[model samples]
Target: MSGLNDRILGLGLLVLAVAYGWVAQQWPEPFGGSEGLGPETFPTILSVVLVIGSLYLMVKPDADAQWPWGKTALELLVAVIVLVIYALLLEPLGFVISTTLVVGTLSWRMGASPGKAFLTGLISAVVVFGLFNYGLSLSLPAGLLEIN
Candidate 1:
Protein backbone atom coordinates (compact mmCIF):
# COMPACT_ATOMS: atom_id res chain seq x y z
CA MET A 1 0.00 0.00 0.00
CA SER A 2 2.81 2.37 0.90
CA GLY A 3 4.66 1.71 -2.33
CA LEU A 4 1.47 2.16 -4.27
CA ASN A 5 0.82 5.40 -2.48
CA ASP A 6 4.25 6.68 -3.41
CA ARG A 7 3.77 5.69 -7.03
CA ILE A 8 0.47 7.54 -7.14
CA LEU A 9 1.98 10.67 -5.66
CA GLY A 10 4.91 10.49 -8.07
CA LEU A 11 2.59 10.18 -11.03
CA GLY A 12 0.58 13.19 -9.87
CA LEU A 13 3.75 15.23 -9.43
CA LEU A 14 5.00 14.17 -12.86
CA VAL A 15 1.82 15.49 -14.42
CA LEU A 16 2.15 18.72 -12.49
CA ALA A 17 5.74 19.10 -13.64
CA VAL A 18 4.81 18.66 -17.25
CA ALA A 19 1.99 21.17 -16.99
CA TYR A 20 4.21 23.66 -15.17
CA GLY A 21 6.97 23.33 -17.72
CA TRP A 22 4.54 23.89 -20.56
CA VAL A 23 3.17 27.00 -18.89
CA ALA A 24 6.66 28.31 -18.33
CA GLN A 25 7.39 27.95 -22.00
CA GLN A 26 4.28 29.93 -22.82
CA TRP A 27 5.57 33.09 -21.11
CA PRO A 28 6.42 35.84 -23.59
CA GLU A 29 10.06 36.64 -24.00
CA PRO A 30 11.19 39.67 -22.04
CA PHE A 31 12.11 42.71 -24.06
CA GLY A 32 15.85 43.37 -23.90
CA GLY A 33 16.20 40.94 -21.03
CA SER A 34 19.42 39.04 -20.27
CA GLU A 35 20.99 37.48 -23.32
CA GLY A 36 20.71 33.86 -22.20
CA LEU A 37 18.25 33.71 -19.31
CA GLY A 38 14.75 35.10 -19.66
CA PRO A 39 11.74 35.30 -17.36
CA GLU A 40 10.96 31.62 -17.79
CA THR A 41 14.39 30.27 -16.88
CA PHE A 42 13.90 29.72 -13.18
CA PRO A 43 10.48 28.09 -13.52
CA THR A 44 11.75 25.95 -16.37
CA ILE A 45 14.65 24.81 -14.23
CA LEU A 46 12.32 24.06 -11.32
CA SER A 47 9.96 22.06 -13.50
CA VAL A 48 12.89 20.10 -14.87
CA VAL A 49 14.05 19.33 -11.34
CA LEU A 50 10.50 18.31 -10.41
CA VAL A 51 10.37 16.05 -13.42
CA ILE A 52 13.57 14.31 -12.39
CA GLY A 53 12.54 13.97 -8.76
CA SER A 54 9.09 12.68 -9.66
CA LEU A 55 10.52 10.15 -12.05
CA TYR A 56 12.88 8.91 -9.37
CA LEU A 57 10.03 8.58 -6.91
CA MET A 58 8.00 6.63 -9.42
CA VAL A 59 10.86 4.27 -10.12
CA LYS A 60 11.97 3.85 -6.51
CA PRO A 61 8.96 3.94 -4.25
CA ASP A 62 9.79 3.55 -0.58
CA ALA A 63 8.17 0.42 0.74
CA ASP A 64 7.98 1.67 4.28
CA ALA A 65 6.71 5.17 3.55
CA GLN A 66 3.60 6.07 5.49
CA TRP A 67 1.24 8.78 4.38
CA PRO A 68 0.64 11.57 6.85
CA TRP A 69 -2.65 11.57 8.73
CA GLY A 70 -4.87 14.03 10.58
CA LYS A 71 -3.07 17.24 11.49
CA THR A 72 -0.07 16.71 9.30
CA ALA A 73 -2.13 16.01 6.23
CA LEU A 74 -4.35 19.00 6.95
CA GLU A 75 -1.30 21.21 7.27
CA LEU A 76 0.01 20.04 3.94
CA LEU A 77 -3.33 20.77 2.33
CA VAL A 78 -3.35 24.27 3.82
CA ALA A 79 0.09 24.96 2.41
CA VAL A 80 -1.00 23.94 -1.05
CA ILE A 81 -4.09 26.14 -0.82
CA VAL A 82 -1.97 29.08 0.28
CA LEU A 83 0.32 28.74 -2.71
CA VAL A 84 -2.58 28.57 -5.15
CA ILE A 85 -4.12 31.63 -3.56
CA TYR A 86 -0.82 33.45 -3.73
CA ALA A 87 -0.62 32.85 -7.47
CA LEU A 88 -4.13 34.16 -7.96
CA LEU A 89 -3.50 37.22 -5.82
CA LEU A 90 -0.07 38.18 -7.12
CA GLU A 91 -1.13 40.53 -9.88
CA PRO A 92 -3.75 42.25 -7.75
CA LEU A 93 -1.92 42.45 -4.43
CA GLY A 94 1.57 42.88 -5.82
CA PHE A 95 4.55 40.66 -5.20
CA VAL A 96 5.36 42.09 -1.82
CA ILE A 97 1.89 41.76 -0.39
CA SER A 98 1.18 38.36 -1.86
CA THR A 99 4.51 36.93 -0.84
CA THR A 100 4.09 38.36 2.62
CA LEU A 101 0.73 36.69 3.08
CA VAL A 102 1.95 33.35 1.84
CA VAL A 103 5.17 33.38 3.79
CA GLY A 104 3.56 34.67 6.95
CA THR A 105 0.79 32.09 6.84
CA LEU A 106 3.25 29.29 6.26
CA SER A 107 5.55 30.52 8.98
CA TRP A 108 2.71 30.83 11.46
CA ARG A 109 1.65 27.30 10.65
CA MET A 110 5.20 26.20 11.35
CA GLY A 111 5.02 27.64 14.90
CA ALA A 112 6.36 31.17 14.50
CA SER A 113 4.54 33.90 16.39
CA PRO A 114 2.12 35.84 14.17
CA GLY A 115 3.96 39.14 14.53
CA LYS A 116 7.36 37.58 13.92
CA ALA A 117 6.10 35.56 11.01
CA PHE A 118 4.56 38.58 9.32
CA LEU A 119 7.70 40.61 9.97
CA THR A 120 9.79 37.88 8.43
CA GLY A 121 7.43 37.83 5.49
CA LEU A 122 7.67 41.59 5.03
CA ILE A 123 11.45 41.61 5.22
CA SER A 124 11.78 38.66 2.88
CA ALA A 125 9.32 40.13 0.41
CA VAL A 126 11.13 43.46 0.29
CA VAL A 127 14.55 41.86 -0.02
CA VAL A 128 13.47 39.46 -2.75
CA PHE A 129 11.61 42.23 -4.56
CA GLY A 130 14.78 44.33 -4.54
CA LEU A 131 16.97 41.45 -5.59
CA PHE A 132 14.87 40.55 -8.59
CA ASN A 133 13.90 44.09 -9.50
CA TYR A 134 17.41 45.47 -9.08
CA GLY A 135 20.14 42.90 -8.63
CA LEU A 136 18.87 40.49 -11.29
CA SER A 137 17.60 43.26 -13.53
CA LEU A 138 14.25 41.57 -13.80
CA SER A 139 10.95 43.29 -13.19
CA LEU A 140 8.41 41.78 -10.90
CA PRO A 141 4.88 42.97 -11.31
CA ALA A 142 4.48 45.98 -9.04
CA GLY A 143 0.67 45.85 -9.21
CA LEU A 144 -0.79 47.96 -6.37
CA LEU A 145 2.70 48.88 -5.26
CA GLU A 146 3.42 50.55 -8.58
CA ILE A 147 4.64 54.09 -8.21
CA ASN A 148 4.00 56.60 -10.89
Candidate 2:
Protein backbone atom coordinates (compact mmCIF):
# COMPACT_ATOMS: atom_id res chain seq x y z
CA MET A 1 0.00 0.00 0.00
CA SER A 2 2.74 2.44 0.98
CA GLY A 3 4.83 1.52 -2.04
CA LEU A 4 1.83 2.03 -4.31
CA ASN A 5 1.18 5.43 -2.71
CA ASP A 6 4.82 6.41 -3.12
CA ARG A 7 4.75 5.44 -6.78
CA ILE A 8 1.56 7.43 -7.34
CA LEU A 9 2.98 10.54 -5.64
CA GLY A 10 6.24 10.20 -7.56
CA LEU A 11 4.35 9.94 -10.85
CA GLY A 12 2.20 12.92 -9.92
CA LEU A 13 5.28 15.02 -9.18
CA LEU A 14 6.80 14.01 -12.51
CA VAL A 15 3.60 15.03 -14.31
CA LEU A 16 3.48 18.37 -12.47
CA ALA A 17 7.14 18.99 -13.33
CA VAL A 18 6.52 18.28 -17.00
CA ALA A 19 3.46 20.55 -17.09
CA TYR A 20 5.28 23.39 -15.31
CA GLY A 21 8.29 22.99 -17.58
CA TRP A 22 6.06 23.23 -20.65
CA VAL A 23 4.38 26.35 -19.30
CA ALA A 24 7.70 27.91 -18.36
CA GLN A 25 9.08 27.23 -21.83
CA GLN A 26 6.03 28.93 -23.36
CA TRP A 27 6.42 32.06 -21.19
CA PRO A 28 7.56 35.12 -23.16
CA GLU A 29 11.06 36.34 -22.19
CA PRO A 30 10.79 40.04 -22.95
CA PHE A 31 13.78 40.90 -20.76
CA GLY A 32 16.26 38.80 -22.64
CA GLY A 33 19.89 39.73 -21.95
CA SER A 34 23.03 39.09 -23.90
CA GLU A 35 24.72 36.94 -21.25
CA GLY A 36 22.45 36.33 -18.23
CA LEU A 37 19.49 33.92 -18.32
CA GLY A 38 15.92 35.26 -18.40
CA PRO A 39 13.17 34.86 -15.73
CA GLU A 40 11.85 31.66 -17.30
CA THR A 41 15.26 30.00 -17.08
CA PHE A 42 15.09 29.45 -13.28
CA PRO A 43 11.62 27.94 -13.42
CA THR A 44 12.64 25.68 -16.30
CA ILE A 45 15.65 24.49 -14.34
CA LEU A 46 13.55 23.94 -11.17
CA SER A 47 11.01 21.90 -13.16
CA VAL A 48 13.77 19.77 -14.58
CA VAL A 49 15.14 19.20 -11.08
CA LEU A 50 11.67 18.30 -9.81
CA VAL A 51 11.28 15.76 -12.60
CA ILE A 52 14.66 14.24 -11.82
CA GLY A 53 13.90 14.08 -8.07
CA SER A 54 10.53 12.44 -8.72
CA LEU A 55 12.12 9.90 -11.04
CA TYR A 56 14.72 9.09 -8.42
CA LEU A 57 12.01 8.65 -5.78
CA MET A 58 10.10 6.32 -8.08
CA VAL A 59 13.14 4.15 -8.57
CA LYS A 60 14.33 4.16 -4.94
CA PRO A 61 11.48 4.48 -2.47
CA ASP A 62 12.52 3.84 1.13
CA ALA A 63 11.37 0.46 2.42
CA ASP A 64 10.83 1.70 5.97
CA ALA A 65 8.95 4.83 4.95
CA GLN A 66 5.48 5.30 6.37
CA TRP A 67 2.89 7.64 4.88
CA PRO A 68 0.58 9.28 7.42
CA TRP A 69 -2.11 9.79 4.81
CA GLY A 70 -5.00 10.45 7.20
CA LYS A 71 -3.10 12.97 9.31
CA THR A 72 -1.64 14.69 6.27
CA ALA A 73 -5.05 14.93 4.61
CA LEU A 74 -6.64 16.38 7.73
CA GLU A 75 -3.83 18.94 8.07
CA LEU A 76 -4.15 19.95 4.42
CA LEU A 77 -7.91 20.29 4.73
CA VAL A 78 -7.57 22.44 7.83
CA ALA A 79 -4.92 24.60 6.18
CA VAL A 80 -7.16 25.18 3.14
CA ILE A 81 -10.08 26.07 5.37
CA VAL A 82 -7.95 28.49 7.39
CA LEU A 83 -6.61 30.15 4.24
CA VAL A 84 -10.12 30.55 2.85
CA ILE A 85 -11.39 32.04 6.08
CA TYR A 86 -8.41 34.38 6.28
CA ALA A 87 -8.97 35.60 2.71
CA LEU A 88 -12.65 36.16 3.39
CA LEU A 89 -12.01 38.15 6.55
CA LEU A 90 -8.86 39.95 5.47
CA GLU A 91 -10.50 43.16 4.33
CA PRO A 92 -12.99 43.54 7.18
CA LEU A 93 -10.76 42.30 9.98
CA GLY A 94 -7.58 44.00 8.76
CA PHE A 95 -4.15 42.48 8.07
CA VAL A 96 -2.98 42.31 11.66
CA ILE A 97 -6.16 40.71 13.01
CA SER A 98 -6.59 38.24 10.15
CA THR A 99 -2.93 37.27 10.04
CA THR A 100 -2.71 36.82 13.79
CA LEU A 101 -5.82 34.64 13.88
CA VAL A 102 -4.66 32.52 10.97
CA VAL A 103 -1.14 32.10 12.32
CA GLY A 104 -2.29 31.28 15.85
CA THR A 105 -4.82 28.74 14.63
CA LEU A 106 -2.30 27.14 12.37
CA SER A 107 0.28 27.00 15.12
CA TRP A 108 -2.20 25.42 17.51
CA ARG A 109 -3.13 22.88 14.88
CA MET A 110 0.56 22.10 14.53
CA GLY A 111 0.76 21.31 18.29
CA ALA A 112 2.11 24.54 19.76
CA SER A 113 1.04 25.86 23.18
CA PRO A 114 -1.79 28.41 22.98
CA GLY A 115 0.15 31.19 24.68
CA LYS A 116 3.22 30.59 22.59
CA ALA A 117 1.10 30.33 19.48
CA PHE A 118 -0.63 33.64 20.07
CA LEU A 119 2.62 35.40 20.95
CA THR A 120 4.39 34.02 17.92
CA GLY A 121 1.48 34.91 15.68
CA LEU A 122 1.41 38.49 16.97
CA ILE A 123 5.14 38.91 16.62
CA SER A 124 5.17 37.38 13.14
CA ALA A 125 2.35 39.60 11.91
CA VAL A 126 4.05 42.75 13.22
CA VAL A 127 7.40 41.74 11.76
CA VAL A 128 5.91 40.95 8.38
CA PHE A 129 3.97 44.22 8.34
CA GLY A 130 7.09 46.16 9.26
CA LEU A 131 9.21 44.41 6.64
CA PHE A 132 6.73 44.89 3.82
CA ASN A 133 5.29 48.30 4.67
CA TYR A 134 8.21 50.08 6.27
CA GLY A 135 11.39 48.25 5.26
CA LEU A 136 10.50 47.41 1.67
CA SER A 137 8.12 50.38 1.20
CA LEU A 138 5.45 48.13 -0.30
CA SER A 139 1.91 49.50 -0.31
CA LEU A 140 -0.22 46.96 1.55
CA PRO A 141 -3.87 47.73 2.20
CA ALA A 142 -4.34 49.05 5.72
CA GLY A 143 -7.92 47.75 5.61
CA LEU A 144 -9.95 48.53 8.76
CA LEU A 145 -7.00 50.18 10.50
CA GLU A 146 -6.69 52.96 7.96
CA ILE A 147 -5.91 56.23 9.75
CA ASN A 148 -7.48 59.39 8.35
Candidate 3:
Protein backbone atom coordinates (compact mmCIF):
# COMPACT_ATOMS: atom_id res chain seq x y z
CA MET A 1 0.00 0.00 0.00
CA SER A 2 2.81 2.38 0.89
CA GLY A 3 4.67 1.58 -2.29
CA LEU A 4 1.57 2.24 -4.34
CA ASN A 5 1.04 5.55 -2.57
CA ASP A 6 4.65 6.53 -3.21
CA ARG A 7 4.29 5.71 -6.88
CA ILE A 8 1.16 7.83 -7.14
CA LEU A 9 2.77 10.72 -5.35
CA GLY A 10 5.86 10.47 -7.54
CA LEU A 11 3.77 10.45 -10.68
CA GLY A 12 1.82 13.51 -9.53
CA LEU A 13 5.00 15.36 -8.63
CA LEU A 14 6.55 14.43 -11.96
CA VAL A 15 3.60 15.98 -13.77
CA LEU A 16 3.80 19.07 -11.58
CA ALA A 17 7.52 19.43 -12.25
CA VAL A 18 7.01 19.30 -15.98
CA ALA A 19 4.23 21.86 -15.78
CA TYR A 20 6.30 24.10 -13.52
CA GLY A 21 9.26 23.99 -15.86
CA TRP A 22 7.03 24.79 -18.80
CA VAL A 23 5.48 27.75 -17.00
CA ALA A 24 8.89 29.03 -15.94
CA GLN A 25 10.04 28.97 -19.53
CA GLN A 26 6.98 31.03 -20.51
CA TRP A 27 7.99 33.98 -18.28
CA PRO A 28 8.61 37.18 -20.20
CA GLU A 29 12.21 38.28 -20.66
CA PRO A 30 13.19 41.14 -18.42
CA PHE A 31 13.50 44.62 -19.86
CA GLY A 32 16.98 46.01 -20.81
CA GLY A 33 18.17 42.56 -21.97
CA SER A 34 18.60 39.29 -20.07
CA GLU A 35 21.27 39.08 -17.38
CA GLY A 36 23.00 35.89 -16.28
CA LEU A 37 20.27 35.12 -13.74
CA GLY A 38 16.73 35.82 -14.89
CA PRO A 39 13.39 35.49 -13.06
CA GLU A 40 12.90 31.93 -14.36
CA THR A 41 16.24 30.62 -13.12
CA PHE A 42 15.15 29.58 -9.64
CA PRO A 43 11.86 27.99 -10.73
CA THR A 44 13.59 26.15 -13.54
CA ILE A 45 16.21 24.83 -11.15
CA LEU A 46 13.52 23.79 -8.65
CA SER A 47 11.58 21.96 -11.37
CA VAL A 48 14.69 20.01 -12.34
CA VAL A 49 15.30 19.01 -8.72
CA LEU A 50 11.67 17.99 -8.29
CA VAL A 51 11.86 15.87 -11.43
CA ILE A 52 14.89 14.02 -10.08
CA GLY A 53 13.35 13.55 -6.63
CA SER A 54 10.06 12.29 -8.04
CA LEU A 55 11.87 9.83 -10.29
CA TYR A 56 13.82 8.48 -7.35
CA LEU A 57 10.66 8.10 -5.27
CA MET A 58 9.02 6.17 -8.09
CA VAL A 59 12.02 3.86 -8.40
CA LYS A 60 12.61 3.25 -4.67
CA PRO A 61 9.86 3.91 -2.13
CA ASP A 62 10.20 3.33 1.59
CA ALA A 63 8.22 0.22 2.50
CA ASP A 64 8.00 1.15 6.18
CA ALA A 65 6.26 4.45 5.51
CA GLN A 66 3.13 5.21 7.53
CA TRP A 67 0.37 7.70 6.90
CA PRO A 68 -0.72 10.21 9.54
CA TRP A 69 -4.04 9.54 11.27
CA GLY A 70 -6.59 11.36 13.48
CA LYS A 71 -5.04 14.30 15.33
CA THR A 72 -1.84 14.31 13.32
CA ALA A 73 -3.77 14.40 10.06
CA LEU A 74 -5.98 17.18 11.38
CA GLU A 75 -2.92 19.18 12.32
CA LEU A 76 -1.51 18.71 8.85
CA LEU A 77 -4.77 19.92 7.35
CA VAL A 78 -4.71 22.97 9.61
CA ALA A 79 -1.17 23.74 8.49
CA VAL A 80 -2.20 23.58 4.87
CA ILE A 81 -5.17 25.86 5.51
CA VAL A 82 -2.95 28.36 7.28
CA LEU A 83 -0.51 28.36 4.37
CA VAL A 84 -3.33 28.94 1.89
CA ILE A 85 -4.63 31.81 3.95
CA TYR A 86 -1.15 33.24 4.23
CA ALA A 87 -0.79 33.24 0.47
CA LEU A 88 -4.13 34.92 0.02
CA LEU A 89 -3.42 37.61 2.60
CA LEU A 90 0.21 38.35 1.74
CA GLU A 91 -0.47 41.09 -0.78
CA PRO A 92 -2.90 42.93 1.48
CA LEU A 93 -1.30 42.35 4.88
CA GLY A 94 2.35 42.51 3.76
CA PHE A 95 4.89 39.71 3.84
CA VAL A 96 5.85 40.39 7.45
CA ILE A 97 2.33 40.18 8.86
CA SER A 98 1.18 37.19 6.77
CA THR A 99 4.38 35.23 7.32
CA THR A 100 4.35 35.97 11.02
CA LEU A 101 0.81 34.69 11.39
CA VAL A 102 1.48 31.48 9.45
CA VAL A 103 4.80 30.68 11.10
CA GLY A 104 3.55 31.51 14.60
CA THR A 105 0.49 29.32 14.20
CA LEU A 106 2.52 26.42 12.89
CA SER A 107 5.09 26.77 15.66
CA TRP A 108 2.40 26.88 18.34
CA ARG A 109 0.73 23.83 16.80
CA MET A 110 4.05 22.02 17.17
CA GLY A 111 3.97 22.70 20.97
CA ALA A 112 5.96 25.94 21.30
CA SER A 113 4.61 28.52 23.78
CA PRO A 114 2.46 31.25 22.15
CA GLY A 115 4.80 34.11 23.04
CA LYS A 116 7.93 32.31 21.86
CA ALA A 117 6.26 31.18 18.66
CA PHE A 118 5.03 34.67 17.81
CA LEU A 119 8.40 36.20 18.60
CA THR A 120 10.21 33.66 16.47
CA GLY A 121 7.82 34.33 13.61
CA LEU A 122 8.23 38.09 13.86
CA ILE A 123 12.03 37.83 13.91
CA SER A 124 12.12 35.41 11.01
CA ALA A 125 9.70 37.43 8.90
CA VAL A 126 11.57 40.68 9.51
CA VAL A 127 14.96 39.15 8.80
CA VAL A 128 13.86 37.50 5.60
CA PHE A 129 11.99 40.62 4.48
CA GLY A 130 15.11 42.71 5.06
CA LEU A 131 17.29 40.21 3.24
CA PHE A 132 15.06 40.20 0.17
CA ASN A 133 14.10 43.88 0.15
CA TYR A 134 17.51 45.37 1.02
CA GLY A 135 20.25 42.78 0.56
CA LEU A 136 18.91 41.17 -2.62
CA SER A 137 17.27 44.31 -4.09
CA LEU A 138 14.06 42.39 -4.53
CA SER A 139 11.13 44.45 -3.33
CA LEU A 140 8.56 42.47 -1.48
CA PRO A 141 5.18 44.19 -1.18
CA ALA A 142 4.97 46.43 1.91
CA GLY A 143 1.15 46.55 1.77
CA LEU A 144 -0.09 48.05 5.04
CA LEU A 145 3.48 48.88 6.01
CA GLU A 146 4.06 50.85 2.83
CA ILE A 147 5.53 54.28 3.38
CA ASN A 148 4.83 57.19 1.05
Candidate 4:
Protein backbone atom coordinates (compact mmCIF):
# COMPACT_ATOMS: atom_id res chain seq x y z
CA MET A 1 0.00 0.00 0.00
CA SER A 2 2.79 2.44 0.86
CA GLY A 3 4.67 1.54 -2.29
CA LEU A 4 1.54 2.10 -4.32
CA ASN A 5 1.02 5.50 -2.74
CA ASP A 6 4.66 6.47 -3.43
CA ARG A 7 4.36 5.46 -7.09
CA ILE A 8 1.11 7.40 -7.46
CA LEU A 9 2.57 10.52 -5.89
CA GLY A 10 5.74 10.26 -7.98
CA LEU A 11 3.77 9.89 -11.19
CA GLY A 12 1.52 12.78 -10.28
CA LEU A 13 4.56 14.98 -9.57
CA LEU A 14 6.11 13.99 -12.90
CA VAL A 15 2.89 14.87 -14.72
CA LEU A 16 2.68 18.22 -12.95
CA ALA A 17 6.31 19.00 -13.81
CA VAL A 18 5.81 18.14 -17.48
CA ALA A 19 2.71 20.34 -17.64
CA TYR A 20 4.52 23.24 -15.98
CA GLY A 21 7.53 22.87 -18.27
CA TRP A 22 5.27 22.82 -21.33
CA VAL A 23 3.47 25.94 -20.20
CA ALA A 24 6.75 27.71 -19.44
CA GLN A 25 8.18 26.83 -22.85
CA GLN A 26 4.99 27.94 -24.62
CA TRP A 27 4.86 31.39 -23.00
CA PRO A 28 5.58 34.15 -25.53
CA GLU A 29 8.69 36.22 -24.84
CA PRO A 30 8.58 39.98 -25.18
CA PHE A 31 9.03 41.30 -28.75
CA GLY A 32 12.29 43.12 -28.03
CA GLY A 33 15.50 41.04 -27.94
CA SER A 34 15.13 38.88 -24.81
CA GLU A 35 16.00 40.50 -21.51
CA GLY A 36 17.90 38.54 -18.78
CA LEU A 37 15.84 35.41 -18.19
CA GLY A 38 12.15 35.43 -19.08
CA PRO A 39 9.47 34.72 -16.46
CA GLU A 40 9.44 31.11 -17.69
CA THR A 41 13.10 30.42 -16.97
CA PHE A 42 12.65 29.85 -13.23
CA PRO A 43 9.53 27.75 -13.72
CA THR A 44 11.27 25.64 -16.36
CA ILE A 45 14.18 25.02 -14.01
CA LEU A 46 11.84 24.23 -11.11
CA SER A 47 9.84 21.84 -13.32
CA VAL A 48 13.02 19.99 -14.24
CA VAL A 49 14.03 19.78 -10.59
CA LEU A 50 10.58 18.49 -9.65
CA VAL A 51 10.79 15.81 -12.34
CA ILE A 52 14.23 14.73 -11.18
CA GLY A 53 13.22 14.67 -7.53
CA SER A 54 10.10 12.65 -8.31
CA LEU A 55 12.12 10.15 -10.34
CA TYR A 56 14.59 9.76 -7.47
CA LEU A 57 11.76 9.24 -4.99
CA MET A 58 10.18 6.63 -7.26
CA VAL A 59 13.43 4.70 -7.47
CA LYS A 60 14.31 4.68 -3.74
CA PRO A 61 11.42 5.62 -1.51
CA ASP A 62 12.00 5.45 2.24
CA ALA A 63 10.79 2.10 3.61
CA ASP A 64 9.92 3.59 6.98
CA ALA A 65 7.69 6.27 5.52
CA GLN A 66 4.24 6.59 7.05
CA TRP A 67 1.61 8.79 5.43
CA PRO A 68 0.10 11.13 7.99
CA TRP A 69 -2.88 11.85 5.80
CA GLY A 70 -5.21 13.23 8.45
CA LYS A 71 -2.71 15.68 9.91
CA THR A 72 -1.48 16.73 6.47
CA ALA A 73 -5.02 17.31 5.22
CA LEU A 74 -5.85 19.45 8.25
CA GLU A 75 -2.70 21.51 7.85
CA LEU A 76 -3.30 21.97 4.13
CA LEU A 77 -6.84 23.12 4.78
CA VAL A 78 -5.67 25.64 7.33
CA ALA A 79 -2.98 26.93 5.02
CA VAL A 80 -5.49 27.34 2.17
CA ILE A 81 -7.83 29.23 4.43
CA VAL A 82 -5.01 31.52 5.55
CA LEU A 83 -4.02 32.21 1.95
CA VAL A 84 -7.60 32.91 0.90
CA ILE A 85 -8.11 35.32 3.76
CA TYR A 86 -4.83 37.08 2.97
CA ALA A 87 -5.80 37.46 -0.70
CA LEU A 88 -9.27 38.75 0.14
CA LEU A 89 -7.96 41.28 2.64
CA LEU A 90 -4.91 42.45 0.63
CA GLU A 91 -6.56 45.21 -1.31
CA PRO A 92 -8.89 46.43 1.42
CA LEU A 93 -6.84 46.21 4.57
CA GLY A 94 -3.38 46.72 2.99
CA PHE A 95 -0.24 44.59 3.21
CA VAL A 96 0.68 45.10 6.85
CA ILE A 97 -2.74 44.50 8.35
CA SER A 98 -3.74 41.67 6.04
CA THR A 99 -0.41 39.86 6.27
CA THR A 100 -0.29 40.23 10.05
CA LEU A 101 -3.80 38.87 10.42
CA VAL A 102 -3.16 35.90 8.15
CA VAL A 103 0.21 35.04 9.68
CA GLY A 104 -1.05 35.42 13.25
CA THR A 105 -4.09 33.27 12.52
CA LEU A 106 -1.96 30.58 10.87
CA SER A 107 0.54 30.60 13.74
CA TRP A 108 -2.25 30.30 16.30
CA ARG A 109 -3.76 27.42 14.35
CA MET A 110 -0.33 25.77 14.33
CA GLY A 111 -0.17 26.08 18.17
CA ALA A 112 1.83 29.24 18.83
CA SER A 113 1.17 31.54 21.77
CA PRO A 114 -1.04 34.51 20.78
CA GLY A 115 1.55 37.09 21.84
CA LYS A 116 4.35 35.31 20.01
CA ALA A 117 2.19 34.93 16.94
CA PHE A 118 1.28 38.62 16.90
CA LEU A 119 4.89 39.73 17.35
CA THR A 120 6.19 37.40 14.66
CA GLY A 121 3.42 38.29 12.28
CA LEU A 122 3.95 42.02 12.77
CA ILE A 123 7.68 41.70 12.23
CA SER A 124 7.22 39.57 9.15
CA ALA A 125 4.74 42.00 7.64
CA VAL A 126 6.97 44.99 8.32
CA VAL A 127 10.05 43.27 6.91
CA VAL A 128 8.22 42.15 3.80
CA PHE A 129 6.69 45.58 3.31
CA GLY A 130 10.09 47.21 3.72
CA LEU A 131 11.72 44.87 1.24
CA PHE A 132 9.06 45.05 -1.48
CA ASN A 133 7.56 48.48 -1.11
CA TYR A 134 10.45 50.62 0.21
CA GLY A 135 13.68 48.92 -0.79
CA LEU A 136 12.47 47.51 -4.10
CA SER A 137 10.36 50.59 -4.93
CA LEU A 138 7.30 48.53 -5.82
CA SER A 139 4.06 50.40 -5.27
CA LEU A 140 1.91 48.21 -3.05
CA PRO A 141 -1.56 49.54 -2.30
CA ALA A 142 -1.66 51.40 1.02
CA GLY A 143 -5.41 50.79 1.28
CA LEU A 144 -6.98 52.44 4.33
CA LEU A 145 -3.65 53.40 5.90
CA GLU A 146 -2.30 56.87 5.22
CA ILE A 147 0.81 56.46 3.10
CA ASN A 148 3.78 57.98 4.92
By TM-score, the best candidate is 3
Off by over 4 Å in 4: 69-73, 80-104, 115-148
Worst 10 residues of 2 by lDDT: 30-39
Give Cα distance to truth, residue 31, candidate 2, Å. 20
Which tens-of-lDDT digit does each residue in 2-69 have in candidate 1? Answer: 58887888999999999999999999878765457777887899999999999999999999987799
Model 4's C-alpha root-mean-square deviation from the true structure amounts to 4.3
lDDT of 3 by residue, 28-94 (tens): 9888897776778778999999999999999998888789999999999999999999999999999
How far is 76's C-alpha from truth in model 4 (Å)?
Answer: 3.6
* Whole-model Cα lDDT of every candidate shown, in order: 0.92, 0.82, 0.91, 0.83
Tens-place lDDT digits, model 4, residues 1-148: 4566677788899999999999998988756767666657668989999999889778867766775689888898889988987898899999888888888888977889999998889999889988767665555667778566
Clash count of each predicted structure:
0, 0, 0, 0
User: Which candidate achieves the best lDDT against the true structure?
Assistant: 1
TM-score of each: 0.85, 0.56, 0.89, 0.61
Q: After superposition, how far is residue 132 of candidate 4 from its true place, in Å?
A: 7.6
**Model 2's TM-score against the true structure:** 0.56
CA shift at 39, candidate 2, in angstroms? Answer: 16
Q: What count of clashes does model 1 give?
A: 0
lDDT (Cα, 0-100) at 130 in candidate 3? 98
Candidate 4 displacement at residue 77 in angstroms: 3.1
Q: List candidate 1 stretches off by more than 4 Å.
A: 32-34
